[model samples]
Target: MKLNIAFFGSSLVSSYWNGAATYYRGIIRALAERGHTVTFYEPDAFDRQKHRDMEDPSWARVRVYQPTEEAALAQLKEAAKADIVVKASGVGVLDEWLEQAVLEYCGDSTTIFWDVDAPATLARVKENANDPFRELIPEYDMVLTYGGGNPVIDEYTKLGAQYCQPIYNALDPSTHHPVEPDSRFSSALLGFLGNRLPDREARVKEFFFKPAQQLHDKQFLLGGSGWEDVAQTIPNLDYAGHIYTRDHNAFNCSPLAVLNINRDSMAATGFSPPTRVFEAAGAAACLIMDYWQGVEQFLEPDTEVLVARNGDEVTAHLQNLSVERAKSIGQAARARVLAEHTYSHRAEQFEQIMKAERTSRAYV
Candidate 1:
């Protein structure tokens, strides 16, 4: 069937300063390349001008909706026109009433609660009994996750999610390929982008900052937003706030090694790898990541990726690996991602899930 799809989220169609937005852009574009018509809906409240990160995707049509109750209701009504409607997590603008309205107005449309941040969403639902959207989990035709593996599936299913599938983050080779090495952002040990949850912030300090502080002679670079006030007291520490998505390859190219840190919940629950990991690896930058459950599924420890459990391990990896060895590891990781973790692969999985859900609904 030729599906006309509409994606609803906080910042999909729009280029928001979040990984979910990138995921949305990549996956939707891939889906469009496969011949699906996808329309994206996002709020216009955010500063769309600061979107220096990604190019205006040519594949999908984007519509920025008004950020008012009446306007949201209007969007819901418009969404009813599509064959499939996807409500992604972290639309920052959605409230209980908005979520309820999405369910109420999505008449005959296959609705998907695509939880990009499963751990965070589940935590919210657990804490609030009055959260109206909690009861609507199972109401959706299917649930799609960005990274969480089995544990996330169990949590959502326990909360009455009928069907859940892990979509997982993937690499977009066109945008993230190895570039000529540069020295501007180069470091013997470096870290790139992220700042949201305090837990992740702390992990970055533990895994990256502390190590940099300890290895006084080694250089470290930090990228991403919300770190403007982050104290840069250490001599080796360098802060590059908010690198655009388009410059990700150039930024990664400069780093002899890059650090990857997962959120505390993701690390504890396991199987969640942020897009940055693949993004860095896609650029063939050596990755030194914190120890997380299911790290092996994506890359082998010590070979494909350097695993760090503490500051000491991180320092050791940076000190021990030669540039040639680091480059080789990065190259291997990049090959793995290109082979298994690309937006095209993700879109294929998404198509399969939609097809299976449609067939099941027919029988029901």
Candidate 2:
């Protein structure tokens, strides 16, 4: 059955500073391919409008709007007509108002609160008993998260979510595949790409900075925003400011082994896998990720991807890096992602979830 889905998200066209653009593009494109109509509504904020990398994606109708109360209400009214109206997390601003407006206006549509940062959202609600989202949780038809696995599911359920499911981040093989390593990044012993957020800075310090300092003999490349303010005492660590999404393939393939470090909240939450994991895997880059609770569920440790708990472990991986072994691990990870963790797979799972929800609602 064809469905009309209206999504309120961070961005679909601009990866400028938006982390979820790749995810939105991959999933929405797959949904459109499956005969669904998708309308993505993004707020013009954080210079996203100025730095739009993709103006017109054939898969979805991209609507950029101002965040005025009047505009929001009007958008909410229009979005209410869809079969599914998704209110995604981290819209950059006015999250509370948007959540309330979506729930209030999405008349007969299946309202879904899709939390891309489930751990942070849950942590906020846990800290404040009177948080509006706490009351809004039960009202939504379903709650979907990009990560947070069973722990997130249980917490949402306890907080009176009618239904909760994790739609984990997946690779888009077409967009992110093994590419010829760029000479610029290929010389680096290790590389990491992420915006410096407060929640993740300490972990970056622990897992990334300290390790880079210890491995001063080897070159380390860091890319993303906010590092300009960071003190670059480590002589070997190169800061490539603000990398574009288009460069992800080169960024992944260039490094001998890419690093994956979770935000502190996500690390504590255990099952959350960042998008970088899949992106690196898709590029067939050897990955050495900081250990988390459900690392085994997504990729096998020590074989498909190497796991590290501390600076010592990360240093050991760097110290023991062999070209043949790294290639083997990268290839295995690529194969695993292609088979089980692609956007096509995620789109199918989303279809199944929607079908099951519809069936359950019919019975009710």
The per-residue C-alpha lDDT of model 2 at residue 143 equals: 98
lDDT of candidate 1 over 96-164, digit per residue (tens)? 666677678995899888888899888888999877778899888888998789999998999998899
Per-residue C-alpha lDDT of model 2 across residues 119-159, encoded as one tens digit per residue: 99999999999998899999999999999889999999999
Lowest lDDT sum, 10 consecutive residues, model 2, at: 228-237
Task: Measure candidate 1: CA RMSD.
Answer: 1.7
Runs in model 1 lying further than 4 Å from the true structure: 13-16, 52-55
Each model's TM-score? 0.95, 0.98
**After TM-score superposition, what is the CA distance of residue 219 in candidate 2 from its true location, in Å?**
0.7
Q: Candidate 1: worst 10 consecutive residues by lDDT?
A: 48-57
